[model samples]
Target: MDSVYTDVGQARKAVEQHLARACAWVDMGGVLLVVSELVTNAQRHARGQWQLRVQAERHRVRVEVSDSVPLPPRWRPGKLDGSGGWGLRIAEQCADTLEVLTSARGKTMRAQWLHPGRTGVAVA
Candidate 1:
């Protein structure tokens, strides 16, 4: 459903927990990274609180972070030197489908990744 995360660490734990055994197929490390970026961006760039919503299907998992600010996310070109402004790029690279939706009130950054396997849990 929907949740509000004041802290990035706690939000990550909740996301992993909710995804359950499905994380085995969805690359949990990548998923968590995307979540961290989205949530942190919302907190740092937007006013008021941020909301986290996740939807897990048979083939893919989608994570969305919404905020009150209507400003759109900026995409920075790839670079060898690691620095700021890389969050959007990282999410774009990791996700199967990445989107930024803007409305009159605010915007939502959505990241989706396909599961690695069709089974309940992928074998390691």
Candidate 2:
């Protein structure tokens, strides 16, 4: 979680490794997708450091991205133009729960994912 750039590959790798260690069988692709969007938004808006946290629980994987910006996200709808501005929308659709929280220092975007077998996400 560097302040300079949001490396999506690194985030994905970290999450994948964590899941592997825990022997969790959650939806890795959806978790990676949510991580990518949160990091992307943090890089685009948050003016200061952006930190990524991934936690593997007994039945869920929680991904959180904390940034310096205190303001909340626009939460815009998906675009039909195909120019590629649909990160948050895709996250909403894929993740089981995506939330935003504010703190004294900044804001955090949290996304949780469950296994496809449990939630019928069918996103293989």
Model 1 RMSD, rounded to 1 decimal: 5.2
Tens-digit lDDT track of model 1 for 13-81: 888997886555787888899999888777767854788988887787889999878889777665767
Backbone clashes, each candidate: 0, 0
Provide the overall lDDT of each model, using Cα atoms, as 2-decimal numbers: 0.79, 0.77
Q: Can you tell me which runs of candidate 1 are displaced by over 4 Å?
A: 1-5, 77-83, 117-124
Tell me each candidate's TM-score. Answer: 0.80, 0.80
Question: lDDT of candidate 1?
Answer: 0.79
lDDT of 2 by residue, 8-76 (tens): 778778778887887457777777888888887887778646899887766677888998888888866
lDDT of 2 at 102: 91
- Residue runs of model 2 more than 4 Å from their true location after superposition: 4-6, 80-84, 115-124
Poorest lDDT segment (10 consecutive residues) of candidate 1? 115-124
